[model samples]
Target: MSYKEFLVQLSEASGVSGYEGEVSDVIKKAFKEIGHEVTSDNLGNLICFKKGKNPKGRKIMLAAHMDEVGLMVKDIDANGFIKFTTIGGVDQRTLLCQEVIVHGKEKVYGIIGVKPPHLTTPEERSKPLEIDNLLIDTGYDFEEINKLVEIGDVVTIKRQVYNLQNNHIAGKALDDRVGVAILYYSLQELNKLQHDVDVYFVATVQEEVGTRGATTSAFKIQPDIGIAIDVGFGKTPELNQFDTIEMGKGPAFTVGPNIHPGVFNHLKTTAKDHYIPYQVEVAANHSGTDAWPMQVSCSGVATGVISIPLRYMHTSVETVNLSDVEKSGKVLAHFIASLNDENMEELLCY
Candidate 1:
């Protein structure tokens, strides 16, 4: 399948924090088709370990979160309307009037309902709806709703993949879904090259809630180098030029205290030497990606980050450029291939 088609299938699948079975199934199937065996940790983190030629060589890790910001059923009212709570860092403002899929006993389709403008006071209309006031209308009565949905079932906004001009596409859950896509592309690229380091590509769970998956997985793998693939803010009129990256350029290589200087320099030089396009994103402290926890895991690890420029993050209409994803994966494969015993020692020295 094409990368975009796989990405859309991933985005449309429901996988909230602590509940990544559906997403795991899709990714595992893809990995298995490529002759890689998939394993899961106690925390639901999916791990695929590819052994390298050198047994004593350095262990490398690539991480991307699989969970996306969404909602969960908090309660079911007497009238059958579903009251829900936020999962991860959901924007309450965007939950109104959107179609949603509730993963319960069965897939339940519903729409978030809001007060009509005719009934609302002008002052109320001036403000966005709050989570407390939002209700999901499933068009099913209490008994039917209970039979299908239960409290704590996850709800994801339904968005069709809309292809835009150039290679950009719009949909929900692209924040780190694109990051997961990088793992797929990287695996394909790695198969063509000879690398000495055993690479572990992880599809982590519950990252939207916290970097829970990265923390535990890093401790388990304890790789010499960890690279987190994620999304960064894309260019928009309201955002500052210095704070956002332009779409269709390439992935962003981050530089900051949290990032290992040696790894960062290698990634930059690899991109340049190989003529792979890339942008730079500066982080003051925590990059808010899987790299955050991986850096401090198991006596501390050297961590790096690569982000695809993303528009409207954490919303249903999240946008990304497929070219950027392609470049990011290529750069990563090259960086991994460039790692050797001598350079790995130097990189870990400081």
Candidate 2:
């Protein structure tokens, strides 16, 4: 499937942090289509294994999260209005009047209800709306709504991927869905290479809440090298240069405390040798991705991070450049092909 088509389907699937099953199914099918051995761990992480030419070679893991920030029904009012708590890191500012899909006994469409500007007092208008005060109106009366809606139902922002100028696209869940798509494409590219390392493509869950899936999966895999593919802040007018990487610049490989210097250098060299357009990301301490947990897994796994630049993170309109997404897949495939028995031994050495 094409990247655009894959992303569209992925973005539309509602897979909130603790509820990633829906998205996992789609990913599992994709992996199976490519003939990879797919399995799910007790923690819901989907692992796809592609055996290398050398059966005893180094194990390399590529991780991308399958969860997106959303909401969960907390209460159902007598009048049929649904009250919810933010699932991950939802921005209250983006909640007003937005369309959402509530996963209850049945699929229900709802809209966040905001006080009409004219109805709000001047004091209220001066302050940001609190999440506690937000309500989802499904247009169903109490009796009808109660039968279909219940507390604890997952809620996701409703959005479809839309293409923009300059090879960019915007939609919800691109934060990591795009990363997952990159993995799919990378696997495809790897099929054409003579890599000597076993590759584990992990579609991890609950990364929005924490790097929960990566933590457990990395421990189980005990990979020689772990690479976390995730979304990073993209440059926008509202963001400063130091805070955001540019979109369309190609995939970014991180350098920092959380990243193994040797692994980072390896990826950097691979990108340079292949002439893949790329960027550098500096994370002072925690990389705030699966890399954080993967780095400390087991005794210690040499971990690196490659991120796709995304705009408007954790919102329904997250955006990324498709060109950069494609580039990331190629870079990963090339990096894996470059890992030989000799270099794998030096992956973590200073």
Candidate 3:
């Protein structure tokens, strides 16, 4: 599938944290077409294995999460307004005035509503609005809404993924969905190359909630090397120097507690050898991605992270560059193909 098609389909799918069945189905079908043996872990991670010339040479696991930050209904007010609690971290300022999908008996449209400025006292308008004061208006009475909607249904922002100027793409859920697309394309590219190591392409679930899927799958796969593909913050007008990376430039190679130095260096060297553009990301604490779990699984796996430069992360209009996405896929495919039993041994020695 084309990158544009992949982005649209992933962005449109509602797979909030702990509810990733729909997104998993899409990923499963894509991997099946590439002739990989697909299976699911106990925590709902979709693991696809492609056997190499030497099945026992080494194991490499590439993971990308399939969950997005959204909301779950908590209560339906007497006036039919819906109250909710976030499934993952959500900025309250962005939630106001945004459109949303209320996943009720069937999908229903709703708008996040708040007291109008005219009604609010000047003192109230000056302070930041609290989440409890906000409500979702679905244009239905309390009895009617209760009949179609339940307390635990998911609620995602209603937005269409779009292509912006300068090869940038914008939409919701690009945080890890873009990672999912990159992994899928990389598998397709890897199929054309002759490699000596077995590779597992995993579509992990509940990463936003706490990397739950990766933790379980890593213990099961016990790979020699693990790489988590996810989205990183892009340069924005409001962010400071340390907070943003340039867009359309290249993918970011993470350096952090979650990454093994040997694996990171190998990836960087491979990128340099292939003349692929790449950026460096430094994280002092936990990297907050699937790599966090994969690095410490069992006896500990050598882990690394690659990220697509994304703007407006965790918002309705996240943005990414198409060229950056393609280059990330190619770089990963090349890195995997460059691995061999001897080289993998050298990685272990470090």
lDDT for model 3 comes to 0.88
Q: List the residue pairs that clash in candidate 2.
A: none
Who is ahead in lDDT, 1 or 2? Answer: 1
TM-score for each model: 0.98, 0.98, 0.97
Off by over 4 Å in 3: none
**What's the candidate order when arranged by decreasing lDDT?**
1, 2, 3
lDDT of 2 by residue, 248-336 (tens): 99988899999999988988898899999899999999999999999888898889999899999988899999999889999999999
Residues 1-350, model 1: lDDT tens digits: 66667798888887888888898899988888888999999999999989888778689999999998889999999999999999889988888889999999988999998888899998999988879889999999999899999998999998888999998899999988899989998998999999999999999999998899999999999999999999999999999999999999988999999999999999999999999988899998999999999999978899999989999999999999999989999999999999988889998778
Q: In model 1, which range of ten residues has the least summed lDDT?
A: 1-10
What is the lDDT, from 0 to 100, of the residue 244 in candidate 2? 86
Clashing pairs in 3: none
Candidate 3 residue-wise lDDT at 334: 92
Model 1 C-alpha RMSD vs. true structure (Å) is: 1.0
